[model samples]
Target: MKYSFVIPCYRSEKTLGKVIDEIQAKMSEMNHQDYEIILINDCSPDNTWGTIRNLCSKNENIIGINHAKNFGQHAALMAGFHFVSGDIVICLDDDGQTPANEVDKLLAKVIDEDYDVAYAEYAHKQHSGFRNWGSHVNKVMTEVMLGKPKELYISSYFAAKRYIVDEMLNYKGAYPYVIGLVLRTTRNICNVEVNHRERTEGASGYNFKKLLGLWMNGFTSFSILPLRIASYGGSAIAFIGFIYALYVIIRKIVAPTEYLGWSSTMAVLLILGGLILLVLGLIGEYVGRIFISINNSPQYVIKNIINYDSVENKN
Candidate 1:
């Protein structure tokens, strides 16, 4: 069967070529020929695009796509998915940490088990404590949002049947978390244990702040839990205020000599003020998503596109 591999490259110049070489070797080992590799450049400042161009010149099966701006990895993946023409599509990071050879195993699971998607689960994660914590938060949020199995491993490395890819592409949202999209699309998902290696070079693109932002994005985009929580909180606060007012009325009626206390008034004011802010923040989050969607913002811009005969030949 024909296969397409979509490798999303950011500042991956350090190991992109190595990953490609391993994929080629794996394909050769499996005696597979009807495959193409699509390298998407997410406007890396490094020589990642240059390396991809050099590889494309040497290999007919390799195609290159350059973006006008740096969209995140998922946006680049979406762009690559749009151009793929294969029975199956596999997405792998260009960082070389994920073993390209193990792709065959994922493919086997998809084919043999008749699964829509097969993903790699690292036998042991080689990331720091903070990263691991962030991953766990992401997983929990995904489970709460999409209602998928909590154990489904969401990795950049996965092989999907053509229909799954098509279904994913049909999702047109600004905040497109690929793992969530896949889970929403199909339930025939399986995983294979694979090795995860340390990064060959360069620090990760996501720092603590960026990771927190991603977490918020995933939470807000997939679920309305935050909004619901805010609603419940406001209602609870209002009920407490009503009870307090009733207490004050009873106290005033029972003890005509007693005066209203300043401390109690201040406490009530502070609680109400805090609740108002919390509710506003929740509304802001939902409004922000709607504003972003209505603007028709492109997830990733294409500064340039390479290897498409139609565009290249036209010029």
Candidate 2:
């Protein structure tokens, strides 16, 4: 089968060449040549593009796509997908953390198991504590939203059949979460345990702030639990206020002196005020997504294309 590997490169000059070499070595061992590696430079402010160009110059099968700007990982993946014309398309990070050797296992599951997509499941993660926690949160949210088997943890290292890639790319939204998109498109998914390694070169691009942003984006784009919780909370608060008003009325009528306390009044007012703001914020989150979508903003802008086929295709 023809395979197209899409690697999103961002300041990966140190490890990109080694990863490519590993992939090529493995492909040679398997006697597979109908393959191409698409390296997308996400406007890295480093020598990443130059290194990729040098590699491509020696190997025609290595295609280099330099984005006009840094479009983030998902956008870079989308851009790479457009150039892939293979039976299967696999996406992996430029970082060497995810071993290239395990890719064959994922491909086996996809081809032999008759699964549309086979994603790598890391048996052991090498991330920090907070990163692990964030991953767990994302997993729970995905399970609740997609109603899939919770065991299937979506890994960035996955092999997808060409049709699945096509369907995922068909989605025209600014906020593109690849796992979410895959779950929405197919249920014929499986996973294979893969070896995870520690990053040997640069620091991770995703920090605490980016992690929080991703969490918020996933919550707003995929689930309505937050909004529903806000609605329920507001209703419960309103009910409590009505009960308190009733108690005040009954006390005033039964014994007028029983209502001579400002503490309860102040407490009730504070609770109500907090609840109002919380509800408004929840609504605002949804509204904010809609506002961004309606503006027809490009998900990512390309400033230059190193070996891109067409200049007009630059967006």
Candidate 3:
């Protein structure tokens, strides 16, 4: 069974070559003869494509894909997924945070244990405090939005079978969340402990805004739970307003205030106004995403591809 790696690269010119070398050394050590490495450059500003071209020239098994623009990591992975022909496909980061040496741990589950997907569980994650917090929030959101298992850690580092990969590629939404796609596709998932190395090069591209965008993708793209939440919240707010209105009416009948109760009236108006606007915004998010999809905004586009077509992996 040949193993194919679909690695997403963005501004990783400095470290990508080293990562490929590590994979070559490790896979060779494992005596894995039939394998291919497909690298997708996510339109990095740095010379990532040039480095990928160099690597492809040096290694016959390497397949390089260049995106027209940066379409986020998951989209880049999808581009690579379109061309893999291996029995098992492993997804990893361009940086060495998740080492290629840990590939064996994930591969063992699929090859020996007969697991459909093997997610890498880090004993001690090497992310910064802020990034770790973002990840924690991301995990919780996936649990709530995508109905992911509470204990199932959905890290980008995972190994999946070709069938599952095909199932995942069926998704054509404008906002693609790879882990969410996998969870929606299958229930046979497993997690394994692996070593996590701290990034020794450029910082992660995820900012506050990007993290928020990812959260939106997980919530708005694959699930309608947010719309349901808005409905529930609006209903609760209306119920409270009804009770408040009854109280004010009773108060006016019992003893009409000399002051027309302007303060309390304004307070109720403000509260109800804010809640209505919030609900509308939530509704608008869903509608806007639908409109975008209807207009056919592409998830990603390939500007130039090299060393991918002729290289075939015979299963």
- TM-score of each candidate? 0.92, 0.91, 0.97
Model 1 residue 300 CA deviation (Å) reads 1.3
Clashing pairs in 3: none
The global Cα lDDT (0 to 1) of model 3 is 0.89
Task: Mark the regions of model 2 whose C-alpha exceeds 4 Å error after superposition.
Answer: 307-315
Q: Which candidate gets the maximum lDDT versus the true structure?
A: 3
Off by over 4 Å in 3: 258-260, 313-315
lDDT of all predictions: 0.85, 0.82, 0.89
Taking the tens digit of each residue's C-alpha lDDT, what string does model 2 give over 94-198? 988888877889888988888999988888888778778878877887787656588787878999999998998886767777777788789899988988999
Cα lDDT of model 3 by residue, 158-185, tens digit: 9999999999888888898898888888
Q: What is the lDDT of candidate 2?
A: 0.82
* lDDT, residue 266, model 3: 88
As a whole number from 0 to 100, the lDDT of residue 184 in candidate 2 is 78
lDDT of 3 at 302: 90
